[model samples]
Target: MRVITVEEHFHHPEVGPRVMDLSGPPPIDLDADFSTFWRNFTPDRELAEQLAGGRLEHMDAAGINIQVLSHGAMTPGSLDHPDATGLCRQVNDWLAEQISQYPTRFRGFATVPLYDPKAAADEMRRCIDELGFVGTLTQGTFAGLFLDDPRFEPVLAAAEELNSPLYVHPGIPPASVLRAYYSGNWPASVEFLLSSPAFGWHAEAGIHILRLILSGALDRHPGLKLLSGHWGEMVAGWLDRLDEAIGWGHYLDRPVSDYYRTQVWITPSGMYSHNQLKFFLAEVGADRIIHSEDFPYVVRTNVADFLLNADIADHEREAIAHRNAEALLRISPL
Candidate 1:
């Protein structure tokens, strides 16, 4: 099977310093930087080489045929950062450069400088129309403001018109949550900081997509396609209840699950829980499922083995491995 993994990630080494230069003082994330996690996850030298070099050989070894590259998690700054547009351009250019050298084995997700919505929409158009990008990845929010903010509607409209799906990744919970709630020690900050990537991250991403749903972005931009990782970021299986709660106040244009089923796509993202996959498949069906590995951050395992060995029917497994990605991404079958 040809494997086309989305959510493969890379980082520009200079991104931090540049964002700091333009973003004024950085957030707490910059100071603490979660070095403890990133250090062990990617390390420095090998990750640098992976970003600077190529991963075709590694993909071949692992039976991953292609990777749609995205910025690691969220882009590391507020959208209000003064140089957000420039930083976005630099990131997108670098992504395009990396993919250009290995077009057959890689694809690019454009970054839009979203501090300025007009500029972001324009950039989205350029990246897709001119740069041949597959789509763009916007993490949970630009700072705390979800993309459902009216300012960002143009970007959503542009994404739909251009046929570029928007992949919404997770972002950090507020610093207030970290400071007052999750601060310090095993049951608190330590566990939150560690487990957030697994559980908390999914909740945050789910909420963000939920905002897109309840905030009526999906209703306005009916053609919009939203992608989320970790089995639809906890939204896939619980649609009936989600709609039930939301519908208590006012009727939505459609049920929350209907919007989700039509507008959202999910990926496994190196999270290899057999039960989770089966449950997710049952909830969301196989059409909205796609392949992902979360790349260097979770690089030890082979996703191909998960696809081949997971307790799923052959056709469903084939869809998750590559067929769905091919249709969603508009790529020719190998």
Candidate 2:
């Protein structure tokens, strides 16, 4: 069976040196710049290969056929540099070159300068039309602002007009959020186990996607395609409770489930739990779910075996593995 992994990650190889070279350094905190995720990434030979050309070797080792890669998420100060717009173009073009090298085995989502929404949308268009990218992926808030803001309407409008999907990846909580809930210094191992990204990012992702729903962005562009990973950041679990607003019938034009079922897609990146997958299937149906490995982050390469051995039937497994991603991304099956 063809296995298309949608939650793969990459950082622009030039990003670090480029950021360090910026003229006026931006504020380094999470009020806007929250990259507890990628700020500290240091590449070894193995990591370098994964970020660049040698990705195919690992995919072959894992027995996966194709991978859909995206930059992890944008932190506030990342693109706040004077040369940010140019950097966005550079990253998107570099990804296009990488995909062009192995058009069959790899494809990528575009990275935009989210600090400027119009520039972001314009780059999104350029990636999709000019570079042949599948779509665009961003994570968390836009400089501490959610997508519902009118400033982002151009981005949403472009996604609708161009038929490009927008993926909301997980992001870290802001400084205030971390200070309130995840504050305190423990040993490095203890922080990694407790507050690092494992617990905080998933909740942050879950909340961001939900905010889009409650903030009525979905209602504006009903045709917009949005994606969430890790079983929708646990949206399936909390969806019903969120729908309690249906009792009053006061706020939304439709129930939250309607928006989720019709507008959103979910992937199980690095989450191989059969129970969680089963619950997502029951709640959102197989069509809205897809398969992903989250790549180097969760670093277990036996996903083909896991999906093949999952308790679900052959048809459902196949749908999650390739069918849904094929339809959404327009990639042919291997």
TM-score of each: 0.90, 0.88
lDDT score, residue 334, model 2?
60
Could you give me the TM-score of model 2 versus the true structure? 0.88
What stretches of model 2 exceed 4 Å from their correct place?
Answer: 20-54, 73-78, 188-196
Best by lDDT: 1
Model 1 residue 163 CA deviation (Å) reads 1.3
In candidate 2, what are the lDDT values of residues 73-137, reduced to their tens digit?
Answer: 33222355556678878877777887887888888888777777888889889999999888888
Q: What's the CA RMSD for each of the models?
A: 2.7, 3.9
Report how far off residue 11 is in candidate 1 (Å).
0.9
